[model samples]
Target: MKKQIFGFKCAFKGIIRTINSESHMRFHIVAGIYVMLFSMFYSFSPTQYAVLVLLITSVMALETVNTCVEDLCGLVADRYEPLVKFAKDAAAGAVLTVALGAAVIACIFFLDFNVINTIFTFFAENLLYLIFLLISAVISAFFVVLGPVGIKEKFIKLKNRHLTKG
Candidate 1:
């Protein structure tokens, strides 16, 4: 029993580590901000919220899987390998699949008058919430872009420094 518990704990820790990694965490944070904004603007019916939640979760989950696949490929192949390329591409394709489906669902939900009317009503009645949503959207966009660009730039600089030293 103790051994089983320990094994479960280890697996849980590994899951947490993967989810908390920079790329996965950045996407999760952005998804969370979008969820909050959506909640502020509209009160989704139970079915609508369920669908929205599932869509968001699917996107984030696929993104995490994509990151894991890329990381595994990098670890296995020090340089480029055809199999690694295929694996990474397939993982990315999964994310794109989920994203496209979610986009369609979002259009269906948002284009309806019921959802739009609720959002407009909320905006008119709750000025503070609307302001908060705007501010959060701006900040979320900045962080989402900044995180990846900063990491990419840092890696490029490091590579250059190593080349100079060599």
Candidate 2:
């Protein structure tokens, strides 16, 4: 029993490491959080919630698997190899397919065409708000590309350099 519990703990640690190391995993996590928050705004039936849970779990799990596969491929070849390329590409393709499927499912379940149109219309009418939204998106993209910790480290380095110059 202790061994089983330890194994589960180790598995969870791996999941955490993957989340920290992989930008796409972090993006998926953020997206999942947003989806859960958005879901609360709607009165989803139990079945719908269950479906959402399943979809979220599958996408996250598949992404973790892809990370593992990519890591393994990297280990298998320090330099370029066709087999490694195929393995990495295949893993990425799997993740992309699942992510796309999840997006379609989300749109079908949560978004209406009219709602999308209204969003675009509102942004069009409110150009300043749209500019702010775009800026926020760019910041988010930077944060996602460089993990939060990486961004903090860069900021700290810049600050220290300026202090030394002064």
Candidate 3:
């Protein structure tokens, strides 16, 4: 049990490392969060939600594998080589392929005009909720683009600037 727990921890650590190093990973995570959130606004069957979950996780897994492959190839090769490039590109292509497929699936699942209008009306009627959602989205954008470490470094720099000013 202890070994299994440790293994899970290690897996989570790898995911965090991937999120920090890979912008695409962060983007996928952020997008997935929002997708799941909006998915709740629509009425989906249990099976539909299960499929969405599977597709989301599949993209995430492929992205993690791509990162691992790219890192391993870079570690193995000191200089540029055709094979190394081939490996990295193939890994990236895999992520892209799945991501595109996921998008298509999502569109098919949730592109109802009535549901979209209802979603729009939901925000329109609840201005406060809309404001909060927009705020969260802006923050999520920063998380996706700058990443956790980058955001922390920015905060540290901001504090230093304030100290210098004082």
Candidate 4:
């Protein structure tokens, strides 16, 4: 029983690592945050919430699998391997497939149910709030991309200076 528990724990850790390592995971996390805020502001039925959760999970899972495929291809392929290119393309295609499905579901839910209309009405009534949301999204995207690069470069430069001094 102890050994079985240990095996399950290791597998869980591996799954977490795969999800966390994928770049798309960041986007999924942002989407999840949006979902949470939306849910809090707009009362969704239990079924709607369940569907949203499943859709988000499916997209994130596809992204994680795509990352795994890319990692495997990199491990096996040389700089100019045709098979590696094929593998990477196939993995990306899978993610695209999931994304397309998610987009359809989102349209069905948001458009068919007039959620977008309601949001637009709210924004029209309160332009300041809409502007705040747009500004926040822009700032978040900017920091998400550039913040890590700045930190990495700073660390690299600090390490080089330390090495030279030593």
Candidate number with greatest TM-score? 3
- Answer with 3 or 4, whichever has the higher TM-score: 3
User: What is the Cα-based lDDT of residue 125 in candidate 2?
Assistant: 95
Candidate 4 structure quality by residue, lDDT tens digits, 72-107: 888887687888899899988988888788778766
**Per-candidate alpha-carbon RMSD to the true structure:** 7.1, 3.9, 1.0, 5.3
lDDT of the candidates, in the order given: 0.75, 0.84, 0.94, 0.74
Cα displacement (Å) at residue 59, model 2:
1.2
Report the C-alpha lDDT of model 1 over 37-91, residue by residue, as the tens digit.
Answer: 6665565688888888888877877777787788889989998789899999999
Q: Give the alpha carbon lDDT tens digit for every residue of 70-132 in model 3.
A: 999989999999999999999999989999999999999989999999999999999999999
Q: Put down candidate 2 lDDT per residue, 48-164, tens digits, no spaces.
A: 889888888888898899999988988889999998999889998998998999899898887866655766787799999889868866776776788777788989999999999
Instruction: Order the candidates by TM-score, highest first.
Output: 3, 2, 1, 4
Q: For each candidate, what TM-score against the reference? A: 0.67, 0.75, 0.96, 0.66
TM-score of 4: 0.66
Candidate 3 residues lying further than 4 Å off, grouped into runs, are: none
Q: Is candidate 1 or candidate 4 better by TM-score?
A: 1
